[model samples]
Target chain A: MTTDVLIIGSGGAGLSAALSAKEQGADVIVACKSLPNNAQTCMAQGGINASFDINEIDTHISDTLRSSHGLGSEQMTRTMCENSAIAIEWLASIGVPFSLDEKDNLAKRFMGGASQKRTYYAQDYTGLKILHTLYDNCLKNGVIFKNERLLLNLIVQDKTVQGATFLDITTGEIEAIYAKSVVIATGGYSTVYHGFTTNGIGSTGDGIASIIRAGGVASDLEFVQFHPTALKKSSILVSEAARGEGGYLVNSEGERFVNELAPRDEVARAITREINNGKGVFLDLRHLRREKLTELLPQEMKLCRLHEGIDMATELIPIKPAAHYTMGGIEVNDSLETRDIKGCFAVGECSNAHVHGANRLGGNSLLEIIALGRMAGINASKFEPKTTAKNQEQLLKDKHFISGVYNFTNQINFYEKREFLGKILYHNAGVIRNEIGLKGVLAAVRQMQKEFTFMGISDKSKDNNTNLVEFIEFGNTLEVVEMLLVGALHRTESRGAHYREDFNSENETFRSHSMFWKEDGVLCASFEEAK
Target chain B: MIKIKRFDRKKEPNSVTMEYPITEGLNLLALFYKLKSTLDPSLSFTGVCRSGVCGSCSVMVNGKPTLACSYTPKSGDLIEPLDYHPVKRDLIVDKTKALHTLNQAQTWIHKTNNIPRDTQNLHRIERQSNCILCSSCFASCPVMAVNSDFLGPFALTRALRYTTDSLELQPLDTLTAIQQNGVWDCTLCGECTAVCPQGIDPKMDIMNMRSKSVQNGFDDPTLANMSFGFDFTQGF
Candidate 1:
């Protein structure tokens, strides 16, 4: 079906865009890979960042810039900081139930590397509440949702993206959705760490990959931020609010290693160093007031109980740094539209709009979505009506893609390969990286990609075929992994999240964003000053 | 061994019951993943955030609705698709139709420019907002056996959430929408509350909604029908 705008995800970014575009009198359809509530946005436990004080916008911008470490553009950071209060206001209007402070104003809490209490929260389920609130508002405004449709390819004609091809999982139908504009908000690539990440099963960076393949530039892919505290066994995140609320990081010898309120990259590396030293890292929340801890960080308390089998409020919680957020995504202009493709925009974790550099600020992701998602939606809706007729041959080809997956001779199972990729990447290039480790990771990934040619799925059923869908996602992951390794290999400096053990320190010469794109279907990367 | 009920609409002999030796994992989802990736490649189930919060990997274990990612599994356990929704495969049920109630009931805040001074009001309705929409309540509710039109637990809870929200303006569409198939229809069996991993008592939320409905001038429709109970007038 044709629409004025077709959103490729239903997370906060896509839903925010949908609400904005619909309000602007544009027909909008949000194609969801999972249900709207199931998007990775719901998994965000930390509260969103917004400056309530009048002069604090400048401070918020500087905090974000400082977090970015050099690569974030001042103008892009300003757009987000300026719109922070407006976003918080809209959220409160839609019943976000942000916690309150002593004077009965919106409560703000400390996040790592922040100058003041600036994050607005709802207990600990901040992202889920915000996402549900935004979704409810979208429904109230009559935004259309098409669920369980995996984005396969964007339909581009003469260098303009006008629509996309979606694999409707329910009926095994290749549905072509035509629109004047499309927004890709399909989240990040942290799922490349698989068993060692806080991302969802669908957080595969497919949207970013599709945009890059469609001739859009992707920026700073190597700078994947490792969250300092995830449950060691399950990798479920323990929010930074724990440290913000006086929790401590204690090594096996009960010695405090680093400042708990350090920025994510610093804290993550410290914890990893502890782990590498044959000592276990633990988050000692036992020192905090039990009642206040339970009241303020309910999700963390519950997660520790369920996943780690311990009462974190009274005990030390074991932890390891896990791949959390990817700083890399489609490069967009001030308008939030892709530099190469008109009528195409990116938002949230999928778009690298120069708001983030190497490591992201703790609460900026939630703020970035509203600021950029609304802007992208408005711009996309204003694009003149255009049509790139559904590529019939490609449609038919993709329609048969699943069946081909089923028919392929069962040789090397890529599921095991996918798992292997995660572990190797985590050990070699996770919190710390160097030339030797990166080269080993690159060789392993290439070998896996070659073996993936013989990929096959035993699940032959046409309906709800997750096996086939995941295999395709694995291919998308392999492409991005290669790009990440190449980008990491070229950058010879320890800067922010992309720390190289060999280089060991940040250098002025390497203070540019890492850019990745495709030339004739081959992935390419370079360190260049972000434009 | 774990017993699983499998069905595929597009395949012949659509229903099958099979047992497989259990795989080692910390939770039921990990075991299911092991089953899918190694032993039996055709096994199908849905999981996203392999944590209880996302609400995607819920299924029936021994006739009880459970989130696979959170619940620990035991030997000889019987795994099946959720009770009410159409089974797409082994353990995945279509939640699309089940989730349509949110749209139908307009379970959203009737937002206004006037924001509340503080978040004190949130404590009252905090449980209602915790729903992850796993549809476990819908699957476990006895009411779905009789009426598919019932708005179900999550939607009703959301209706109550917005209708009673302090920031919401008067004349909420959620209140009116829940009158017919939304609030009054739930039997208040508490089965939804039992299976809820988030500890949200949807039954209490429904009861609160019923009271709010009375305040909003929505009469209990069941009182007019008058057919339930032991019927002492039967001429023995």
Candidate 2:
């Protein structure tokens, strides 16, 4: 397939980009690995942040920077905050039903890391509303959607990106697509934690993996944000809006341990520490009236009742921290274009423009995806088409190489290795990290990589083989996990989500972003001073 | 043991019930995951989020369309793909036709480029806009069983949303768009309202839209004579 722009992953970012590109008269084709609305953006429960009052833009920037802990780019934060009001307006124009107050104003609420009540919501399903609106707008604007197509490799040669190769999951066909520009909005790698995540099943950092396979560089791979309150044992999110709306967090003794409205990093760490101390954390909303709970946080109540069999209006909800967001991904400039690869741009959670710094705020992610996604789309639409013929040969060769390796017979249990890796990642690279634990994880991952080489698929049939797709995703997870550990190991100092036990305090000397790249198939990392 | 109705395309090309050991607290999606991972690697189903938000994992469990992510498996539960759409694989139905109805109904708020002035009265429409397009409502709608072209629940609920939106530029256009296989075709059976995971009452919204259409002097001829019959009885 050929088009003016090929957007991978049809979440909020990809769909927004597709809408922008199509509105700009570009033939946009969105290729998704799963259903269109299945991205993590749809799972966002809290409202999106925007300084609608205009005078609060500086406060928004300061809050974001304070939450990021000095790693977020001021330019990008300002851009995001400045564009937020317009982004909300654009969303409303496209039919996103943002909640309105009793006075008929855009309903705003308090969220962690915000100094003002500027988060606009449509009840509790803000992300779902925004995603559906964008998807509907994309459909109406004639943006072509090719679902069930997994991006396997990015065709890049001589520092230029052409298009990509995708595995059509339905027919199991390896098809190469050519495009003038490609946007990778495949979301983050929070699902690398697997059973302990709030992300969708497809959040395996596939875009970052494909970019790395194309010899691209990614930064800030070490910082992974763990949300404070995922439902115990299931990792389904109980939105921050619960706390933002006057819900409290209590220990097993029913004492409020931490300020519920504190920054996510602080609150998540508190929850982790409480769990570590053997005192279970619980989200208490039993004080709220039934009518208020239903009117305000209906989805949270429904989820709790349906999944955990607990009514929020009457019972205390068991909760814990879980891997929620990836603060690092494919490095991009202000234009949202990859630093190394021309014609390839990354946005949303998949691309680290350093807006979140080390830790992400509750409501800022939706803002970042829409604002940066729109910028990337507008810029990509105007870019001149480049020669993609040379890159096609290399991508095809890489495709065959992956198929040949996976098509082999072996005794290595891929599922066992994946489970082991997830445990290592959650335990060592999880909420708190230390030198010894990080090193241990790195060694374990290196051993698993050797076993993974002999991994084979049982179902070799070329028709909707989910096993093969999962196996491929496991490989990507391994790549991402290795980078995460390496980046965490090299950082050596605590900042934002990268908490180190030995270096428990943030050091000015380590106030720099960690950059990771591959050299001779071995992961290497370095630091660039904060800009 | 849990029994699953699986579509085996290779051998019989028909659905066959198979048995597997059940784990405690496993939703239907997780059961399918376990079955595909251990017993039959070919067992196909669509899931994403594994939460009820995305609506990609809707399936008929014990003859009722609901989200497999939220519906816990019971003993001998008969799992099947949602009705009113062609089954693509085991428990996976083609959602394209259902999704297309959304576009055909022009279910987006007509762009007014004007900021909403007063949104206090928008609570009803806002509640209707919560439709996740899950199609569980559509899958259970009796109106769709007989008339596939009926705009169904989500779409009409969507139309009701925009028609009630004071910010919408063309509210009348939205009401007119749903007049055909739209509100008039619905029997108001409330199946859609019952199956909605988001708690949107499409039946009530459709009735409200019907009243709005009548107020706009666009009543359906079939129902117009019924009102006349009541007027004739009052005269007697």
Candidate 3:
């Protein structure tokens, strides 16, 4: 299929980008790996950040920068903060049911790192509501949606990305999709934590891996935000909204350990420290009235009750910190165009425009998706169409290379290796990190990569072969994990989410973005100081 | 042990029942994942987030349409794909036709240049928009079994959401859109309401939409013909 713009995800960013591109008189198509509504955006229970009052834009920007520990780009931060109200208006224009205040205006609430109550919400299902609204708008605008098509490789010639090859999970066919511009919004790699992640199974960093395999660059991959209130054992998120709404995080001693409204890094570290000290952590919403709990935090209440059989209004919900958001991704400029790839753009969690820097604020993700995604779409639409035919031969060769690997003689168990990789990552690269642990993880990952190359898919059938998909996704996970470890090892300073116990605090020498690239089949890492 | 109804397009008979030992706290989706990873690498099912947020893992557990990610498995639970759609593989049904019903009903807010005021007092509208489109309600809907074109719960609920929005410019058009295979087609059997994971009462939404439709001067064809004077007997 050919289109003026091809979006690689169906979440908030991709859908928003499609809407913007279509409005720009460009034909758009969204290719998603799962159902349209199944992206990480749907799982965003908190609200979106936007200074609706306009006067508070400066405050919002400062709050974001402060939370990011001075690593965020000033230009990107200002763009997001200034355009937030317009993004909220665009959302409301498309009929997002934002919760209203007593005066019937868009309801604003306090998130952890925001100075003002500028986060617009629709109860607790804010992300889901916004996503559905955008998706509905896309349909109305005649944007084509192709689901269950997993992106395999980017078709790049010279320095421009002309098209992509996708493995149709439904038919098991490798097909080429050519486009004038390609937007990669495939979300984050927090699923590298595997069992202890708030991300969906599909958050394997596919776009980043494919781009890297095609010789693209990524930045700041070591900084992964660990949300403070995931349900213990299940890892389902208990939204930060619960805390913003006067809920408390208490230790086993029934004492409030830390300020619940602090930035995520502080709150998460507090919880982890408590748990490590033999003190259990719990989210106490029992003080809130049952009706209020049902009304304000419905999703969180429902997930806890359904998954853990714990009613929030009646009992203390067990809680822990889990891998939640990825602040590092494909390196993009202010317009969301990738640094190395000419015709390719990145948005949402998959692109590090450096707005989040080392730590993300509570509701800025949705804001980034709408504002940055729109910018990427508008900018990508203006790019002239390049010759895309030359990429077809390369795509075919890449397809054979991917499919041919299924027949390799394998001695390693795929599931065991994946679990091992997950453990290594979560233990070493999780909330706290150090040089020794990171180096250990790097060695373990290298050993796993050897086995990953020879891993075999038992089910070779072409149609909806999930085993094959898992195999491919595992490989992507391993590649991204290695980058994360190498980046973590190189940056010895403690900053935001990348807390290295060996190096206790932020150092002036390492105050820069960590960049990762591939050369001669070897992973390389370097730091680029903030420009 | 849990018994799952597995099907593969390439296999003979195309279906078989397999049993596997279940861990105590494992949900059905987790069990399916375990089976796919260890016992049979070909086993396929749809799931993401494993949380109830994303509705991709809807399946019939013991003939009840429930979210596999939320519902824990029993020793003898019989899992099957959702009905009212063609099964693509084991426990995976084609949800395209069912989801397309929303587009058919034009369940989207019309574009407008006017900035919306009066954003408050949208409690009802916000409640109806909580739908996740998980298709569990549609899977359990009895009315859909009889009429394939029936605008299922989520779609009708969405229509109600838009029609009730004070900012909606074409309120009458929104009401008219749900006149066929829509509000009137619903049996209001409460099956959809019972199966909804999000606690959205599509049955109640349908009833409310019917009232809104009547207010908009659109009535059910059967009810439109009824008179105040009732006959004592059918023979009369």
Judging by lDDT against the true structure, name the best candidate: 3
Ranking by lDDT: 3, 1, 2
Please write out the lDDT profile of model 3 over residues A1-531, one tens digit for every residue.
788899999999999999999999999989999889998898887789988555699889888998888789999999998889899998888888888877777888777767688888887789989999888888788999999999898988888988889889899888888899999999999988887788888899999998888889999999999988898877888877798789999999999999998877889888888987899999999989799999888778878877777889999999888899999999998778888889899999999999999899888999999999898889878777557554678667867966786776656768777777777787678888888889998998898787775677888788888888888888898889999998998888999899988997999888799998889889888999986
Highest DockQ scorer: 3
lDDT of 3 by residue, B120-195 (tens): 5377787778888889888898887689888898899889888778667887766787899889988779999898
Query: What residue pairs clash in candidate 1, if any at all?
Result: none
Binned by DockQ into CAPRI classes (incorrect, acceptable, medium, high), candidate 1 is medium
In terms of docking quality, model 2 is medium
Q: TM-score of model 3 relative to the true fold?
A: 0.94
Q: Model 3 chain B: which ten-residue window has the lowest total lDDT?
A: B112-121
DockQ of 2: 0.52
In terms of lDDT, the poorest run of 10 residues in model 2 chain A is A385-394
**Poorest 10 consecutive residues of model 1 chain A by lDDT?**
A385-394
Cα lDDT of model 3 overall? 0.86
lDDT over C-alpha atoms for residue A237 of model 1: 85
Query: lDDT by residue for model 1 over B1-236, one digit each (tens)?
Result: 87888987666798888997875546788788888888887788988898777889999999999999887778889999999898877888888778888888888866563858455676777778877888888888999999988889988888877777777786457788778777888888999999888898899999988888888777888776787665757954
**Tens-digit lDDT string for candidate 2 (A357-464):** 988877899998898888888888887755646455855685686578556675775766776777778878899898899999989888877877687677766767
Interface RMSD of each: 1.7, 1.9, 1.7
List the candidate 2 regions with Cα displacement exceeding 4 Å.
A52-54, A241-261, A277-279, A284-298, A311-316, A388-391, A398-406, B113-117, B172-177, B213-236
